[model samples]
Target: MSKEKLFKVAFMNQGKVYELHAREVNQSGLFGFIEIGDFVFDESSGIVIDPSEERLRSEFEGVLSTFVPVHSIIRIDEVKKRGNNKISDLPEGANVTQFPSPIYTPGKGKND
Candidate 1:
């Protein structure tokens, strides 16, 4: 039987780290973005409930796809199986920096 591919994507969002699984991960057609589709959540944990994971699920509920900034992405991995999706707080003194926007101003016209 042919198996479908799965990927785990980790990215920074609003001062937290979001890690989730999807069937598709690729460079977005939109500039400076990564496209993710077919989000996969744990269906085996019927008796167990994780609030953080639930929050992540609801946040992306009904969304067909999402674009994340390239700089915000920490890593993407093709995995043999799915893992629990979760959000995490950055460790103390963590050295990750957010991507700076507005690298250029198009219409300032030399500032007079």
Candidate 2:
């Protein structure tokens, strides 16, 4: 028997921090994105349901795979088991921000 791999991916989106578990995490073919697939959630908690988990489940429902920009990704780790996935607001004055791509520089040429 072989054990499966589970990944915990954390990222920032719209000023909120998101953490989730997935079976697949790989570098996307796109220029600057990561591919994630096979979301995992526990549904055997019985009568009680966590709002955060429910929210995440609904948000990812019907989603086969998702791509997140490399810069937005905070961290990725391989875990032995899945945890409760949730979204959290960025702390006050948190230094987290969307990575800005350099499109142009407004200085004189290097040769100048």
Candidate 3:
């Protein structure tokens, strides 16, 4: 937990998806629960946790022994990379032109 080091931690237990960026994850009050792994997915925020809680808990169970808190989960499912778009996905037809070209006629008078 050095100041020069950045923690890649993830929390998953309950039903809340949250992410935090800090030099030391342990020092950032993100402790208490053990890291599951080096890979956790935050569906709500659409962020893939670099360090998963499942993996961390198994690997470092003996070194820094702890349990995942049942109340600190940030997400239930891993958010898709595409994300939820608000615009419609319908097909485009010839009648649907995003922009119309300006008409120009030869010798067209301004008054005309």
Candidate 4:
């Protein structure tokens, strides 16, 4: 008998933090993207209705795999059991900052 592996991935998107679970997490062939698959969730547990979990489920529904940018990733951890997958707003006064946008236009350079 072998124990299965599970991973909890946390990442930043726009101005929010997204937490999800997966069986596999690895660097993808695509540049600057991380590949994630085998999403896990509590499909049978209907005791409580969680909007966050429901949103995640709907967002990922029918999707076999996904690619996330490395810069947006906050952390990844291997866990013994799956927890409530969720999306949350970034806390105020947080030290971490998002990637900056380009200041200069491609064709219209500063000199032009």
Better of 1 and 3 by lDDT: 1
For model 1, what is the error of residue 58's alpha carbon versus the real structure, in angstroms, after optimal superposition?
0.5
Q: Please, what is the whole-model Cα lDDT of each candidate in the order they appear?
A: 0.91, 0.89, 0.35, 0.89
Q: What digit string (tens of lDDT, one per residue) describes model 4 on residues 1-112? A: 9998999999988788999999989999987789989999777767778999999999999988899888888899999999989999977898776875543446767777
Q: Put down candidate 1 lDDT per residue, 1-112, tens digits, no spaces.
A: 9899999999999999999999999889988899999999977668779998899999999998999998889999999999889999999999887967853457757774
Stretches of model 1 off by over 4 angstroms after superposition: 101-112
**Worst 10-residue lDDT window, candidate 3:** 81-90
CA lDDT, candidate 2, residue 51: 88
| Per-structure clash totals for the candidates | 0, 0, 17, 0
Whole-model lDDT, candidate 2? 0.89
Candidate 3 stretches with Cα past 4 Å from truth are 1-3, 27-112
- Candidates, ranked, TM-score: 2, 1, 4, 3
Number of the candidate with higher TM-score, 1 or 4: 1
Tens-digit per-residue lDDT, 1-112, candidate 3: 6334333333432232234222322322343343433332233543654344434334444553234453443323333232221112224452432232333445768777
The TM-scores, one per candidate, come to 0.85, 0.86, 0.21, 0.83
* Model 4 steric clash pairs: none
User: Which lDDT tens digits does candidate 2 get at residues 1-112?
Assistant: 9889999999988888999999999999886789999999887968988888899899999999999988889999999988989999988978867867843556798775
